[model samples]
Target: GAGVSQSPRYKVAKRGQDVALRCDPISGHVSLFWYQQALGQGPEFLTYFQNEAQLDKSGLPSDRFFAERPEGSVSTLKIQRTQQEDSAVYLCASSVLRVNTEAFFGQGTRLTVV
Candidate 1:
């Protein structure tokens, strides 16, 4: 019954450095989603994966953002050439699959680019 978790609850980066954040979803979860939440804004979907297959990635801001789930369980989101505009709470969620399900969120990896 492990819940989702993210590392480095906080991160501060330079204006153009790359950073990789990690996410560990609940065991046995088949669907995982990544979202970016700006200050006072609702979480916006960044990408989704079912098992090891990436099902959607339309919300990724730009080519500078990338994500992957190779083993169907653990995943990572990498941001390249970080910008002040990229500063936000990166959240990871997971649910059972194929229907309406509740998504559990982590404390989030808060990235700040200065």
Candidate 2:
């Protein structure tokens, strides 16, 4: 894909359910980031992956949230035991360089916990 791609643009999960969102970044991109955005707010950093290694995950809210980029090109963000407070748009971005560089963002997966 020429741009970042995210699957199931919208997801509805019941409270306590688990949801997995997928992100396919531009091929060969070296940096991938996951962010959570609440309504009308800017994206909040969740995790960052440089290739297959996870360098930063301090922004993850709880143990229930996880992200991985196994082969480096594609990544997944999983939320377990979803709560109503977890409802938000999960954004994925990729850049050729490290943090602070220009990045391309996916449309995001809007998860609604009801």
Candidate 3:
């Protein structure tokens, strides 16, 4: 059962609510990514980390979104000032190699901001 795991499988957030989603990746995986998916759309890359270093975060929608992998194993994504447009599925994935390598994905956390 060692794989990418995300908590709060479903969340209902009131407007402006602050929420933190968690991801526990498989051991020794180096590439970790966060993605957002809205209805009728494909997953959009949010950010990524290689080991404990964040290599890209340009996909983050706004300053209210943040992600970190301090020790290179577990990662957390924080979203503040939630808005209706923020409602979507947050997915966490990990791979043992680079970005183009095969990756394992979590079941995903569905967030609904109302």
Over all chains combined, what TM-score does candidate 3 have? 0.97
TM-score of 2: 0.98
| Alpha-carbon lDDT, every model | 0.94, 0.95, 0.95
User: For every model shown, what is its TM-score relative to the native structure?
Assistant: 0.97, 0.98, 0.97
What ranking of all candidate models by lDDT puts the best one first? 2, 3, 1
* Candidate 2 lDDT over residue span 34-114, tens digit each: 999999999999999999999999999999999998898899999999999999999999999885689999999999999
| Candidate 3 segments exceeding 4 Å error | none
How high is the lDDT of residue 108 in model 1? 96
Stronger candidate by TM-score (1 vs 2): 2
Range of the 10 consecutive residues with the lowest summed lDDT in candidate 1: 98-107
List, residue by residue over 1-114, the lDDT tens digit for candidate 3. Answer: 677899989999999999999999989999999999999899999999999999999999999999999999999999999999999999999999875678999999999999
Clashes of each: 0, 0, 0
**lDDT (0-100) at residue 14 of candidate 2?**
97
lDDT of 3 at 90: 99
Candidate 1: residue 112 Cα off by (Å)? 0.1
